[model samples]
Target: MNKIADYIQTAKLESDKPFCAFLYDLDHLRAHVQARVDSMPANTRYFYAIKANSELPILRALAPIVHGFEVASIGEVRKVRSVSQDTPIIFGGPGKSDEELIGALEHNVSLIHVESMHELRRLNELCAKRDTVMPILLRVNLRGPLPTATLAMGGRPTQFGIDEMQIAEAIQLAKSLPHVKLEGFHLHSLSNNLNAAEHVKLVKYYIERIKGWAAEHDLELSYLNAGGGIGVNYADLEDQFDWDLFVGGLQPMLEANLPENMTVLFECGRYNTASCGYYAVEVLDIKENHGKTYAIIRGGTQHFRLPVSWQHNHPFVVVPSERWEYGFERKGVEDQQLTVVGQLCTPKDVLASDVTVPNLRIGDVILFLYAGAYGWSISHHDFLSHPHPDHIYLGGDDHV
Candidate 1:
């Protein structure tokens, strides 16, 4: 049985207003993360990227399972600290204000990914002012024939990391800086890459490049941060990223090529938590417009914006509502193509585009899956100033 549907039904009985909510299964999230961690090879670590979902409950649930948290801002650093004061944090971002750098230093961040020469200089200065020495990974924008993914941060012109050609110069400068220590390289190239074989090949390429750099510079680095791009398949949930195959291919390559002392780091965000969440909204109206059917819900992109941002019809299930308090007949559509939209004023407030559904009604609930990661975190919550959806957690001690 669908537990989320039961909760939505109960909520509907308790209130007359149209409703929307983000429901997270904490037990599922914990188990999913644990499986990922357990499958990792020796000398490899998994870091949960906090930018995906920094909700306190999510962080608290993930803290015990992950090796550490990968944070991109001072606010994220503080969020992690609030949950686990001593949890290791790897701070990585292109634009870091002096205050944020200082905050990372004060919070005792385990490793900071330095993006540029100027940023490196600034960090060294800050450390010197505090009479402290900090460990860092020089984020490199690799020059390459790289694997194709949904989004590419490197292998092109971007404001993400230092260029590959400039890495030698950056290293020499880091050697001169008294308060900053260079530990390794951060090569986070792609986002939402689903092909497992291609991903393994990419990792192999990263290792070979890092090894060459280490030998040339005569350095013994502690880590090779291959920033995570393992993706979840929203188009077809059953055809997910092949973790077993990826691990099978990766463990052998790491054992053969990578140094025993160094650790390989993966900071995954979407794949870690996306499957454990569902966005539920009540359909308010069914209408026909220019030979097309549209079902308008109580929520909009303001609440959950992943589908619109990606321009893909997010996968969902319609939970039929049995109760009808209206004097008029309940209106619905059956065996027709439907476009699920939200209650926003703009025409772009669509969740799922023209897709065929068996049955849908005015009071039915639409529950969107794979919403635990970028769904809420990347949304413009105050766009139309609609009342926020209820954030409900299930099956965990921290449930509320």
Candidate 2:
């Protein structure tokens, strides 16, 4: 049997209950992460962005590979600590509570990326109470135009980081603070960028801009954090962000231009974990509506919301079923287009719209690809009181 058939057979044997199984190939995930880690320059560090896929198994598998983790919330910090206590971690976000800051200090996290002037002061105040100097990266929203990507977090006015225009003053203010040690800068702006060359340019741009700022201020920075926005091409499977080309371009640039003392850290989230996962939902009913075919599955956008959020058609494969008990023909539409929807009553609960599929049937399964990263966590699970999907890890003797 093929991979799709194998997954469907496994699902059938594991549970008679209705579920959407999120299958992960840990071996693939390990190799993918290791390849990136191996390709990084000597001065560059690789940190897995936990926001991508924080599942315990995923984190556990990556603990032995990645240099450390980049987390946005205190919960994430706690989660990482639970998995591996010794690994380095960097905490960053737009809004962090005083308790969270204190927790980070108590735990002695590797670094914290200060998002704003107020947050800088807040962190300083919290650090003063502990009588400890906290290392920080001034998260800068660059002054120039944002990089071309599906989502831009910086460049324009947003809640992410301190604007580039005010960095000098922020640095000056940090100098006065006794408890906060200003180390470097963190620039993370774009997401889902398909162009590998453009991402390389963005990383170089960050380095040069930070070098200029450091020269003007007469500061000795320790690291320039090229925050993770490295993207995956969901639209075209064949067209991807060429990792080998990206690493090839980065190696020469860093060797020639990067300051010897300053190390660069890359916090990759989506790009690292996106490809190792697959979401499989069984087709419950197939019908024609308004001259269009719709395959209503046991789950919907509440479970897997990436398609709706991106407003793009998600790619899926049809797993054919041989057991048809009814005295009638199998309900299917071959070579034609159909919309895949969930069990929810709302019209917004669509997973794919007008996508091409071959020989789809009611008893068959629809395996959604490229669902490893944002599929599990980003969805609104409580929209309806449906049972959660069963998260199944595909590889490893202990997990399968």
Candidate 3:
């Protein structure tokens, strides 16, 4: 009956399984987003980038509160479409086809973040046939290397936007076409900014550039979108956020240069919606081998897709119950180093390489921390044929 050997001695347990819950701190995410929205000087708007985590329940929770959505594909556009129509959805990507453009415009989407002249002509043909003007914000490549070497090297030389040198030409083209409005200027740098200073630098660059573009062209800037690259707190740093400073970093530039009545839009994904989620998993087996104990969890990289992409570094922790120690005792004897691994075919399928844990018997619950941003569906894929993880919205019911 020693506490160290009992399985789970707690009373308020939801299930007798090791859970894979991605704890969503949505309020915090919303607060972070709203703070950015409210602190802006003038015409500024925000579009929650939905690719980070497209959990339905998570999107359901956020859709009503957000100003708009930034979708990269037709599927994502459809996702937002099913929820709300009033919330403007802007579709942005480099390889969109005529069908996708038609779908977006069919829904009366707020904006099309256009990448090329061919697409502009296509939109003109599509809209002229439909007798409508498609508002667009040209994505310009402003990714001129960040301060960090690793992150700078992490980004590929991509032409996702209308390159900066083509700005004036793009504007002239937009006006001459008669079917598209050059509504705003959009520039999203790569997401590897190690700090906020570079992001601020980007915002300042946009403000100055947009100001000059608008003044020279008499375009009357309506929207100035500062693209999203807000880093998350997956690093486990004690002070994960520098909120006041982050908000302050771009606020001054926005306050100084935004055009009259223009809404500044932000396409934040991980920053606005990632932290407010939890991934629950059940422990399948525990064994000691070669001086290293392993906690093999049931799910694989197919369920949590980031491991396959090598864009993952999430933290894992046990849900703290009043009788957590007793729960561990019921499982086994002494605490040990538990290297958590997935039921994946590849030898590299590791959730966490090394973790200290109270001796866990089969079926003890494990909670992964900071998994809110990009956990399950974004984890890994190929061969498992597993269904995507079920989203369990807290303050609610059993999703499975």
- Across 1-400, the per-residue lDDT of candidate 3 in tens digits comes to 1121122234226454444444455555556566766765445566788888776666766776677889888998888878776678888988899889999888878999888778888998999988989999887775454444223211246758776677788888888998888888777756635467666776777777788888888887678777777676565535454656766766676677656677778887776665555555667677778988777876756676554455444565553333243334444424676677777777777767666675555665565655666666565445576444545554333254
Candidate rank order under TM-score? 1, 2, 3
Give lDDT tens digits, candidate 2, residues 1-400: 1554586766666665544778888888999999999988888999999998999999999999999999998999999999988899999988999989998987769999999999999999988887899999999988766578888888887888998889999999988999999899999887777777878888889989989988998888998998888888888877888889888899998888888799999999999988888888888899998899899998888888899999988888876655556798777778888899999889888888888886887878788888888887899887779877878776754343
- Candidate 1 regions exceeding 4 Å error are 397-400
Model 2 TM-score, 2 decimals = 0.96
Every model: Cα RMSD to truth: 1.0, 1.7, 4.7
Question: How well is each residue in 281-351 modelled by candidate 1, as lDDT tens digits?
Answer: 99999999998999999898999999999999999998888878999999998889989998788999999
Error at 189, model 3, angstroms: 1.2
Worst ten in a row by lDDT for model 2 = 391-400
Which portions of model 2 miss their true places by more than 4 Å?
1-4, 13-15, 325-329, 397-400
After the best TM-score superposition of candidate 2, give how far the Cα of residue 186 lies from its true spot, in angstroms.
Answer: 0.5
As for lDDT, the candidate ahead, 2 or 3, is 2
